[model samples]
Structures are given as structure tokens and as C-alpha cells.
Target: MITYIEELTDQEREAIREAIQLLYRQTYLLERRYDRRTEKYQYTKEYRTCSTHLEFLKDYFAVAGISLEENVHDGIIYIQGETLWGEKLPRLATVYLLILKLIYDEQMAQAASSTRIVATAGEINQKAGAFRVIKSIPSPTEMRRTIALLKKYQIVEPLDILEELNENTRMIIYPTVNLVLSGDHIRELLESFSEEENSGEETAIQNTIEDLSE
Candidate 1:
């Protein structure tokens, strides 16, 4: 990896460095992403850079005890490792994530033609309530923080100004959500929720912001 980087032009080397930083910060790089400004999907330069130098990037992350995995079919590249300590999300944020994953799954199951799945905050809250995940809707402040957190992790992107966010506010749920929580994990969580409801015992859901440094 070092020799490969050394052989690159200065500009190329800089691009690689920037791409590495982006991956470290966002955890995932998609070949294409939703462009809020245009309301369309567009190819990502960072993803192209990463793809062009996959071997070097893998070696670069591997040295830090991180493993980089890519899904060509999904056009996603994400990193994972025990060394990547993640922030524990607040209960409300965790609930929102679960709801978003469920929404994504349902939409994909319908054979939606677009890779980008759009949903509204109202739908998220409704599903949370319908699934009995929360006793009441989260406060705007909590919702704002949750959205910001999810946005930072590249899980969801708000379509409108964040300050104006409300039940009707729409957002794009990124495919990265699938990598974060697998189908089996979602089923396990739902089953746990069911058990909690039956026992009437509040259990803290274990959810962490992945592929991030502490």
C-alpha cells in the first residue's frame, strides 16, 4: 500500500487521503447517493476513488485493525473492526433507526425501482407507535438530535431544512442502514421488544454508531 501510494501523483495521493478521511468519518461510501438539491441520484467521486484504489485502502485500514468490505451490487463500501468503538445511541435515536430499517425493508420488498428509498418523519413515528416501540412520540428536540446523528453516520438525509423538520418532513434512507442492522438483527430486536411488552419490563436497546472512533 505504501509503495502504491508513493507511486501516485501528488493530486492522486491527496485524493486518496481525502477519501480515507471520508470513510473514517462517514463509515460508508456509496457509488451513488441521493442529491437533495436536485432530488436525484448521482454518482459519488469518493466512491470512484475508493473503488479505483480498493487494495490500498484495504491495506490502509487493515493496519489500524479495521476490515473494509464492499458490496458491488449495492455499490457500498463500509468498514468494521473491534478497534472501531462506537457511540451508544440514546433510546429514542435507536428507536428511530429501527423504524427506518423497517421502512427500508418494506419499501425494498415492494420491488421499488429506485435504490434510494424516501420516507417521512411522520411515517417513522407512526411505525414506532404501531410497533409499540415507544409509548409516545419523541419531542422535536429529541427528533432533531436523532436526525442529526443519523445524518452524520450517512444513514438518513433530511430533504428540508433541519430546523423546519416535523412529522411531514421527508428524508432519504440510505442503503447503509442495511449494513448497519441486518435482517436477523432486526428480527432479534423485534422479538425482544415483544418479550418486553409481555413482561412490561423496560429494556434498554443496545445500539451503537458504527465504524467510528471514540
Candidate 2:
């Protein structure tokens, strides 16, 4: 039996437990292997090793039906797939959902363990097979055009995905999830905008952003 007595966040501990519960049967039990040569009791969980944990996350996304791709601009993980809400989710929104669900919420915020990653184009290509086959993966040029259109029109306000970085940095970070017209609250927001807003720029921008991003 491998034992690891360490300070873990509630979520972190739960993730490990889940990994053990879910993956142990297919994979081996995650042993806290002791290096007899060094005589040190390892504190980290071990199942199988890979070049990057993101590779494992790549598999994880596959289990969830979101195809992850690489972005040339920032080299972070990109997603192309259907939305969890049944509406078509854009690559940005898909990625945001995966990050929110699997990585940030389940793995980071909930799980105590830290599995670090920085996404790349090559790995994304290997992992994003489904999206590519489905023609959902957008080219780099398309991504740029969509972002620019969104900014110009005001369909969605860009939140700082990379808060500390200057605007010159191409790192785009913001909630990609937008309220569609069918949403009640979104209708209210649109009504409010129509009443007070002088610029039709917002409407034009929103539609263009959705068209291009999707």
C-alpha cells in the first residue's frame, strides 16, 4: 500500500481519490514509490510517466468529448467541439469549459495536487484529431480575425485572460461563454443595451464574433 501523508486541498485529495478509484483498474495503482538507493519516501503519486501532464489532460479531454488543439499565437490549449449546454460552443468557449471543469475546477481548485502544463501546437495536433476530422478546428488566421471582430463590435467584452500581460502580448484570456438571444438574462442585457446604447457597433460586433468564432 502506498501512503502519502501531505497537506492536500479538499479538491486535490478528492482528485487523487478519484484517479485511484477511476483509473487504477485500467492503470496501476498510484504508488508512492520509495527509491531504495536514495532511501527517500516519494511524496508524489505515480501511475505512468509522460513528457507532460498535459498529454494526460489531452486524453482526459478525449474522455469528455472536447477536442483540444494548439494555438500558434500563444501556444496554449484550444478546444473545438459541441458545448455542454447543447448550443454550439466556439473553440474559445470549449477550451474555457474544459479548463473550468477538468483543469481549474476539478484538478486545481478542487484537487490539491499540482499538475503543471503549457500547451503547444504539436501536442495539440496529436490530441485534437477529432476536432480536425470534424472541421471544427480553426486556423490561426481565423482565430485572429474572430478576436478582432469581437473587439470591434462589442459582442463580448474581453476580460483579461492574461491579466498581467500588456496588450501587445497576444495572450487572449476572458470568458468565451456568451449569452445567446434565447437566454432570459441575455435578453434583458440586450434590451438594456438597446435602450441606452447609441452605437450599433455592439450588435455588429456580436454577430460577427459569433459567426467567425464558431
- The number of the candidate with the highest lDDT is 1
Q: Between which residue pairs do clashes occur in model 2? A: 11-110, 11-111, 12-110, 12-111, 12-112, 153-205, 155-206, 161-173
Q: Write down the TM-score for model 1.
A: 0.80
Candidate 2: tens digits of C-alpha lDDT, residues 1-214 = 1133145456655664554343322221222323334644343332222112335545655776765444332222333345332223344433222222222222234445633222222233333332331134445554444444433222222333323323232322222222222122322232233212332232221112233222
Steric clash count of candidate 2:
8
In candidate 1, the residue pairs with backbone N, CA or C atoms under 3 Å apart (3 or more residues apart, or in different chains) clash, namely none
Q: Where does candidate 1 stray beyond 4 Å?
A: 112-115, 185-188, 191-214
Q: Which stretches of candidate 2 lie over 4 Å from their true place?
A: 1-51, 84-208, 211-214
lDDT of 1 by residue, 78-186 (tens): 8887666445566676667777888898899897475668899999988878777777788888888989888877788888877998899999998878866665456
Q: What do the candidate models score in CA lDDT, each in turn?
A: 0.75, 0.32
Deviation (Å) of 202 in candidate 2: 11
Measured with C-alpha atoms, the lDDT of residue 18 in candidate 1 is 86
Worst 10-residue lDDT window, candidate 1: 205-214
